[model samples]
Target chain A: MSEIRRRDPRREWIARNRLHRDHVSVLAVLGQGNTPSEWLGPNGVMRRNPHAVGFIGPNGLKRIDRSGGQQGGPATVATGTAASDSRQAVTIEAPAFLVAVVPDMSGGRLSSHDRDLLGLARQLADADPARPGAVLAVLFGSHKEEALGEAGVDRLLHLGDDAYEGYAPEARLAVLAAVERDLAPRHWLLPDSPLGGADLGRRLAARLGERPATGVWQLEADAEARGKNGSGWRCTARGAANTRDFLRPLPRVALALAECAEPVSETRHAAEPVTLAQPLPVLLSRIADLGPVAVDPAGVALAEAGFILSAGNGVTDWEGFHHAAKLLGATQGASRVAVDDGHMPRHRQVGATGTWVTARVYVAVGISGAIQHLQGIQSCDKVVAINRDPGCDMIKRADLAVIGDAALVLQALVTLVEQEREEKRHAA
Target chain B: MRPDPQKSPSLAITVLVSVGCHPLTGRGRRADQDARGVELARALPLAEVRLLHAGVLDAGSDAALRGYLGMGFDALTLIEQPESSDVVPALAEVLADHPPTLVIAGTRAERGEASGLLPYLLAERLGWPLVAAVAEVEGVEGGVATLLQALPRGQRRRLQVRLPAILTVDSAAPAPRQSAFGPARRGQLAVHEVGEAVPDAELVEWVEQPARKRPKRLKIVKAASARDRFKAAAAKAEGGSGQVLDGVTPEQGAEAILKLLKEEGVLRR
Candidate 1:
């Protein structure tokens, strides 16, 4: 008897500890049939069985056998029905387009989050071949057209006015309402900025009488499906308790979350400049610009940082925390206990009630992970936890756990990093 | 520096409280928004405040409802409705009959179907301007109220909106004061029967399963080595083979960490 040996490339890939671009796609390739499959769970445990197949669930990857079939049946049924309904109900008249609302910063600069939205817009446009969509950017302040064009934007709708100087929600809403009417886009993408993106997105959704999906991290359009409603877009978002995937018809608005897509640098096409002819509604309220107040660089605003070193109640050495943060050039964060005990400021607290961070790497020291603290760092790419308790929440959720005192571990890390820097300096 | 009391009429504030429970524990308590709403009402001078709840009156909900009354309130209006009935229509009907200068609520409820959609839908139904994530009510003169809207990253925006508006309090609002036991036990739960009870259509079939942890970010390793394999195996273990520096000196522990850091490529030397 001949045996069909289909060796999964991911098994070897996982063994190497190399970075995979998309885990969901990997699961799709592996979890095809009744063949025995091996996969790593979110807790880093590997399970292998004949009945189990690698599946991408809301909470990440799971080895689902036939026994787990009943539990997942309802969620799939719900999404399928909704997708079919939305596809049939909405009719597309104008050319399919993905309009992104670009956020303008204090200076004549575009935020990384906004740039990511442009990249995503371009990706969505390229997905459909029948009527390849166009990507448009609604710019607020003055910006270089070349820079925006390079970030994969096909066209620029520049709104350079004195009213667009700061985070003016009302003025922005009026401008978006006018743009929506003029373009009548199939999908409206807004970057989930702390300044004004969320508010503007919700307000525009209400005005258009459309239900919006917020905190959307992943979106894909089903282009090859049958029926008019079958080819709608599917949006994945992180809800309060669980992650959810839903299908929405055309003319839907979504608030794009951070760290979902990388910004593209190469310009794919020439970006045409456009303008608005209609007058905007009068602003209801005026903002008083307070000059920039200086803040500590290593403070609690670590939401956008690529590297973060956070301390918990287990950390006793404040000096070590500061030293480690400086050595790694990472932002500083603290668990609720550390903030409550006066070891750190209230602004530096990371938890359910505090700031939600999406960093490339998060290093937790001396912090026993409370559920709230774990919730805040859900989007972190790599979590390296150093704690005394092996059974703590932080350790369980971390990709790497080093059992030791936080101060000692941080001190050692700082020392090694400093030595490396000094050796490089001498070589130079 | 106070405004003339005779010129400005006292503002009428109405607060909507919902049954609060711990999302994980399911244990009932006073909702966070209700407490903050009550506290905000207490801070306003020349304000007539009333507390209202629209839900079924049951033994399970009594404890949480009483918890709100414990905040020194003499009575709370409970609009009787079934568990499956829609509360928005009932609340809107009652508010229309007894219009107030301002309506306040928490950003969202903590219990079942906590969609955070009530405030937005209600505002649209009532044709009232909605202000969300308000930290404080700076002042109210004539018909305009100045509000301090809470933004992320420790930033605040001030805006003025016309009165007869709805405001949702964010976590930045002042914490509620302690609830007195005696006042809570003695407080009245007044029942009001108004509006039609419309049953909500249950669209999605809910299946119960043990909560699962979020999926780990997929890491693809390109380096192929015996040391890399060992490191990967160690990282994937449930009760990881982490070196516990129990009884070791801080210097020894530091050295072990330095070795690990270098092996992990977190530090280059």
Candidate 2:
């Protein structure tokens, strides 16, 4: 009953050759889909043939992926989804110039903002393929990201010293200044984020006496350009607190916003380790960092909160809701109805008119999901709705919707969390 | 508005304010972060808070400058400068003339280029330390001020910046007090004619435009294989693919929420 089907090398060669009379039948028997991309015609005129199977790209373009991602139809599609090793390895040896990028590296990962900045750097570096530049990433402290090469970094300058951690903008500024003096990079790109780059970028700009373009979100290769190095480029930056956009020529230094450019998706770089040619200058910093302060989640600002426990009109048991928020270490937020009913302060309201929160996880208990409320939380990664009404808008929007009494659910969650903590404590 | 020298402490705080434009109506108002900086300075005990601005006091910005005055200030020192001129030198000169123990400013302006570099340049020129994204001033001891710096995701860092240092307020700082119409109408803009203005050549050359709406990043199934795409599509559609559990008991609901919380790495335990 058991049979080992072995490979037929001669038949495979004939099917692949495409010149044999029995090629068609051999391919059919081998279950290998036909239609070669190109073959010599009968008269020796070459012909280009389109594949019968092709996938539509993200932009709705019919793209035939020759990386062996798609073939043999859906039946054999599950065989391999090797999208990992498809990146084209690119190395720019003796780059004409350098485009330096300083990523935030928050939580020791290349954040979306950092990736976008790298993408922008890639644009500048890859502008002229004949005289291509290299992207030099300036990393501070330590990082856990393993895909620095895939993130479009050509050169890596890591400062793993303990003195560069915490709020050491002064020391970080000194490193950037040294980089500027030694490498003389063509362009300096940094995320216009408050975490660290925004502070350090401004200091570097001041020290270099380069009027950097801050709050930059969009960039265009200009027709008529003028600059010392970053010429032929223009940028659009948000100004007046995002009320207007300032279109200006791209300068030597640029502090860009998140999503300024699409991250490098198709290529991998060397990410070769580099070093400062000179030693870092010791600074007599007047600001002394005392490390991080432990802040209660409840005291966290709504816009800055990573996880939010938000309540709504249906939240009857206010005491249980507050208890759950405190126990879960989640920031407290309220819907407009809850705020208007005086159950919560207006500042805590979550809606279009209220703070447009970018929390990673938004837990909406008893929220009906008003249009404005949904709009305000549009940027949140996950929405958890706990409501009795399954047909509510919040339930539809939630990644996980729990239909039940808000009070009872809160009580059960609190009890479950307490039990988990108690078990962990006992195990320790 | 000077307090009696014998009664008041010698702590001087100056908040640099800028005119803000409403995103929808384009109306002028007090810049959000500057107002927060002013609020932070005012919340500090026994500190003399002064509002400073360096831009043309036109009708549009006059109302905006007065908005800061409405926050219980008698006057705002407005150093007259042209539209395309660099204001850092003027603001730096004022700070150097009467160096304050602490200078507060917004992360960035709401008008013009709004590079958010004024404070750094001022600090560099004055040779003083500069702290960015400060949430609150805990207290001042001797000549150093202990400040709470706001980090991403609601975390904070404690720092001690020496006297005559500049601080830039983060958006996470405590909200500003509402401006009063009565004070806004009565408050005078103490306009000062400064020295010759140096036109910002780069700013004058570039064009200005309305903010363009960025395209939303679509969650495209970037699968390399047809099988992978088919599997991804079958697993979940764009929207309306969420799981809704009905007729579940409170304990069951709690279990589902806990599972999701754990999956998202939000549950600490």
Candidate 3:
């Protein structure tokens, strides 16, 4: 991966042979970003937030709800201070802008969860007012103004129109029409939601003549990082593959930078908002012109992801897996057997017929380290395994080994990460 | 293309039901247990869409016959089959006869074969696009019906295909809603006698095993008391502490122990 140099950043122009440089804007399909309250305590039990309405604490740790209504329950009742004066703002100066494909951010009867998500976006927007990005929230269905007004959208693109309801494919085509017209960004950002990213990514990639990678957390163009030689940022991602490719999960983070003199990360710009309403007429006229689509980007390249936490059968039990995953800010998954048992989705399954993942920090929890499973994840920069039996194959494969139950080790890890993060938050 | 402003096609989606066979208890099909079949029928923008409550059958064929009637299908056709080498052929027969626009089947039937092969085979035989793990069927348009395929990691994909397609639904599909017991009981089931009877294959041997359990093996035993947990940790510590070498070595060991304590959260700097 080429490094982004600040001194001589990539120029904004139509560089020769640069397919990516021509791209101009981005759209981020926003969803609820939540901080889970209860966790699996060290004792291998599900912990509830005591402040969470009626539930008991997760072991002994007192649940601190940011909203403060419940001590131990999952519901985050706001004390209201977090959003008391929040407003949407952006800080990037790129020719591009930020546009969020949001659900109904209008109307009066907003759900608490949507309210929190809006608050988060508002906070981020306010923190950086210099950026030109405007929030474009897509409402799910028909609703009156009273249903959306409070969610805090900079510019609302009401999708409740008859054509936009139903499947996102139609909505996407309309969105693309709008995108091509006003805010046609070179790249598009979508949440890795089960309901949205899977099909839309493939369809969009096909539409744009680009390959999309499903479940990508980060994306960038290579041109932003590499100099003139950069064509586009390589995308690193993991998804369900043939049984043969299931053992190893590809990197979950991807960067699709453009080819340019400067690195893409240096030019890393948040999504900006552009006018989508104007293109409706033209798109309506020419939609039939679109053809069959292509698949999302294949998980063939890992351009520049330094750290990753890959899980397999090793991370057993939903509770324990979630605990370890939260500690690392990592995506969670399972082995084929676990997926078969219905604990995790077959997509998150990692094994011979599952997703292939390789990262710098590869931690194997309870996975027995089968040859097929190992084959998929062996590309990781490092390997750490925790199992009750030291004689397991995973221990032999690991650069580090701890002989203990995966659940116990994960609990310890969660505590350590939380302690460190808490200290840092206080310090900040 | 603007959907015909005048008339939208009336599409009726039919879901076939089959029960898993018990060696002794026989076969029982739960057609009413199906909500997705109903949901898919509802998703169509047709004038009339109905759910077929196919009756319990000894084989996949038995269910298909009842499904044909319960769904208020335009016609009834029997799907003939030989000794059950597999139910794929029976399905093929029905699909060939009816040539229905949309055929939906459960990914797996709780049956003697219980193999989730019918949907895939049907797709291959019928040469229609098959979508598994479907959460929703958005709508059918211009000879193509749009479907919402649910992928792993909570991702959903939307697909559009012409009619005469087959979709096999997995458990991940939307949960079926409760049917009114009254209407379900009174629903008419017309059974068509299968004519193209294929000889049934003889079963050699059937091997059965217990269902697989989730792989969460790490068990953490909560201690009765915090002091007990501390004692257990102390007891579990393999190395004996405090070896005073009375010089440089002693200081190095002490520093190492303190570092370990700090790292483990037993001590905080």
- Chain A TM-scores for all candidates read 0.45, 0.67, 0.31
The runs of at least 3 residues in candidate 1 whose Cα sits more than 4 Å from the true structure, single-residue gaps closed, are A1-95, A100-112, A142-146, A192-195, A220-231, A240-251, A260-269, A283-428, B1-8, B55-60, B80-87, B112-115, B197-269
Q: For each candidate, what's the DockQ?
A: 0.06, 0.45, 0.02
Per residue, candidate 3 scores C-alpha lDDT tens digits across A1-428 of: 56963321132222111255332221011111123235443444665544323444678655443323454333333424433334333234442354343332222233333443344334333433555444445455565445233445454555455565444354555575456456554334334332343334334444454433332222234443345323233333322110011111112111111110111111212333334545455233111212222222222122222233445555556676675565454455566666776776666655567757655445566777777777766555455565666566666776555665566566666666567769988999
Q: Which candidate would rank higher by TM-score, 2 or 3?
A: 2
Residue-level lDDT of model 1, residues B24-134, one tens digit each, is 677788888778988898788887788999998888788898888898788999999987677888999989999988999987676654445567667767877778788
Model 3: fnat (fraction of native contacts): 0.01
Candidate 2 lDDT tens digits, A1-428:
45975656677568667789999888678665575554444444655667554756678878765546454455235444334556789999999999999999976778889999999999999998899999999999987789999999999999999988878888888888889889999999999987667888889988998889988888888776654444889888887667668887888899999999999989999999999878887778788999777679877789979899999989998988988999998999999999999999998999899999998789999998988999999888789999988778888789988998899999999999999999989999
Error of 3 at A98 (Å): 54
Backbone clashes in model 2, listed as residue pairs: A240-B110, A240-B111, A241-B110
Return the DockQ of model 1: 0.06
